[model samples]
Target: MAREITGFSNPLVKRVRSLREKKLRKREGLFLAEGLRILTEARELGVLPEMIFLASGADPHPLASALINAVEAAGGDVIFTTPDILGKMSGKDNAQTLIGVYRDRLTPLPALDRARAPIWFVAQAMRDPGNLGTLMRIGDAVGAGGVILVDDCVDPFSVEAVRASMGAIFTQTIAHASWDEFLAWLRAGPGQLIGTSLNTDQDYQAPAYVPPAFLLIGNEARGLPAGYEAACDLLVKIPMLGRADSLNASVAGAVMAYEVLNQLRRTGDQGTAPQAPE
Candidate 1:
């Protein structure tokens, strides 16, 4: 049977509310995911929630049922509470009766993985949670290996980010690293590192890309750091037809990702470049 917490002052309610604050989330090593879609996606992503809270008055919508089932299958418990309690716990202007407290997920990249080679997106100092989430979803559509976030990027698990990703959050791998660590990793990489910059002399489509390649997308407003441009093997830019100076970070990232995919397909069509004289 599901447990019931009637009062808004319940201890569990306070614990759940704390997740909304960054300090609390970090201290507890847990975060809250609102709505059924996010919770369901979390389950599919192999993230098991410790507990899920469902609002008493909110009918179990189909999406909610799916999320409840996932939680049950994972041997997790679900709690029921009144709307008043939910509002208190959620701390959102628009409260969703359903909320999940999931285990933190962090996966390390293996050494030069073949399956991912020729496609990777690097987010350097991207601070917007929404933009980060959208980029992850875009990466998924284009069959990207994963996303590498430099140290200054926003928390992928932020509430706004989870909503923006629309469940794509569960499908992508997000690896975080310091700038120095990223530089070292790039140096040992499978392909060259390409960065986007205003001063870039070459067009994005100019190069015939190789597999295991990486395209760097820096901050949307400030662009990439000066030192980073020098570190990259090649600097490239997207051609802008309109008056806008440049595309949004997420748009720029998706464009570059598809470009790499297109080149790979084109290379395949050309047929293996004929084995050299044996």
Candidate 2:
């Protein structure tokens, strides 16, 4: 049975709401993920929230009910609250009935199994949580190993990012490191680093992208620093036939990731050098 709470002044409610703050989240080592679909993905992915807040007397989603059972079975808490309290915690006037407080899953770069998948997505200094989240969604779509966040990127655990991910937050592995740290780690392994840039004349479609390829997109405003671009094993540019000078960082990343996924999927291609298999 779930505990029922009616007050907006509840301490646990405050704690769940505080996760919206980066400092509080870092201090707590937990983050907030909301919605039946997102929480369902988390449960299916073997991630159980430390606590779940459900609107009392509201009709429960079938999956949401399953989540509550799994959570309770795992010794997690389920709190039933008024809809207003749920709204207060989620900062949404029309908040979903279900919200979850999950442990942050960002891993260290060295902990990543680069060989776990054929492609991986990398982002540098991306400030927008929405863009960062969308890139993670793309990582999921391409069957990439994970999303490697380089440098001072947005917190992947932010509610905005998690919401933007539309549950891809649970589907994709996430890692973060500085440029130097990520580059050094990549160099120590068999991965290929492909960067998107305006300085490069090479076409995006022209490369025989290697398996375990790391597809990197630079910061939204300035893009990858000069030293970073020069460090890439190959740099390719998407042609802009329209008046737009460049693509949105996440959009560019999606285009690059799918192409890489296509290439690597065509053959168990591994380290094969040709663009296409005979």
Candidate 3:
């Protein structure tokens, strides 16, 4: 049985609402995920939220009901609340029927698997949560091993980023490191460090990306810091046909990431090579 929460001052409600603040979320080590799709994806990924809140009288879709039941079976609590209460917690106009409280899932830099062609997207000083989320989704879509956030980047756990990810946040592995730490890791690892730069005349497609490649992108505003290109095994640029100076960080990353996949696929490295003329 789901308990009914009617008051705005409820302790659990307050806690969930507080997650909107990065400081509070960091202190508590938990974040909120709103919407049925995200919650379902999280559940499918074996991520069990600490608590679940469903708006009373909201359409009880079969999947949502099943998720609620599963949570209760697993000793997790489920609360049915008014739409207003849910909206307050979700910080939205009309909140989704299901909102979940989940623990943060950031991981430390893992040992690069030199035996396989693993791709990693490295974002340096990325500040836009929406862009970061989109990048995460792109990373997940292209089967990248993980996303690495360098230095003081925007919080991926923030509501905007998580929501923009459209559930990729649950599936993708996210890592963090400082500039110095990343440099050290790059030297110690067997991966090729690839960077994007306008100064480079090389087309993005020119690189025959090796296994365990790290695609390093810079901040949205200023681009990569000075001398960073020296560390790259290869520097490539997406051709600018229009007047724009550069594509958005997320767009540039997606373009480069897909190219890497395309190269690998054509080369038959991952066993997805095109068929020969029959």
Candidate 4:
């Protein structure tokens, strides 16, 4: 049986509650995972939890049951507490039913050349968690390499972002890097570098895509940084027919990803040479 943990005053509860702050999350190299889908993805990604936190009424939630079974099977620890205590620990109104302590992937940046096989979505200073999550899902959909959270973006592992991702987070390789490091990699990396902007004279569909490209998507409100505009080998813009001006960050990212993937597939299809029979 999972150990029943009572009281919000417990030291473990206090520790879990502290995870709401980014500093604490970074310091501990851990993050919170709420809901069944997120937990399931974490497990499938081979992310063994350090510990599992479940509310008293959590057994009824399908995700909660799955999480308990998964955790127990992995020989991990599960602690049962009250909903009120869970709410206090999670720092969110909707976080009561299910939660977990997961070790952040924090996988070091691999050889950027190795990563070049897949397309990449780089979002700079993106603020909305939902937008970031949606972009991750899109990257997974198009079989892109992964989504890179460059510079001042929201915590990709946040409860909101994880929930918004709909479990797509597990299938994607998410790396956070500084602007200098990211730029350095881009300059030396194997993939073609592409940036998106409203001022670009080039249409999004005008040029044929050459993979392994990094399609840079900027913040919804501010767009790309000043330096990012000049960093790309080419900058392209989506044609906007309406007065609204711009698409959401997620929507823009999805369109660009699909277009690039389409072009790459076409190129691959054409490159396969016919074999002559003896």
Superposed Cα deviation of residue 13, candidate 1 (Å): 1.4
TM-score of 2: 0.95
Per-residue lDDT over 63-126 for candidate 3, one digit per residue giving the tens place of the 0 to 100 score: 8988898888888888999888999998887765589888898887655443333678899999
RMSD of every candidate to native, in Å, equals 5.2, 3.2, 3.1, 4.9
- lDDT for model 3: 0.84
TM-score-based ranking:
2, 3, 1, 4
Question: Taking the tens digit of each residue's C-alpha lDDT, what string does model 4 give over 82-154?
Answer: 7778778767674565677887754445543334345788889999999988888887777776777788899
Model 2 ranges off by over 4 Å? 270-278
Global CA lDDT computed for model 2: 0.86
* Clash count, candidate 2: 0
Q: lDDT tens digits, residues 219-252, model 2?
A: 9999889898899899999999999878999899
Candidate ranking (lDDT, best to worst): 2, 3, 4, 1
Q: What TM-score do all the candidates reach, one by one?
A: 0.86, 0.95, 0.93, 0.86
Misplaced by over 4 Å in model 4 are 57-66, 91-96, 110-117, 267-278
Q: In terms of TM-score, which candidate is strongest? A: 2
- What does candidate 1's lDDT look like per residue over 56-96, in tens digits? 66579886777777777778878888777777887765465
Residue pairs whose backbone atoms clash in candidate 2: none
Candidate 4 residue pairs in backbone clash: none
Superior candidate under lDDT, 2 versus 3: 2
User: Given candidate 3, what's the lDDT at residue 183?
Assistant: 81
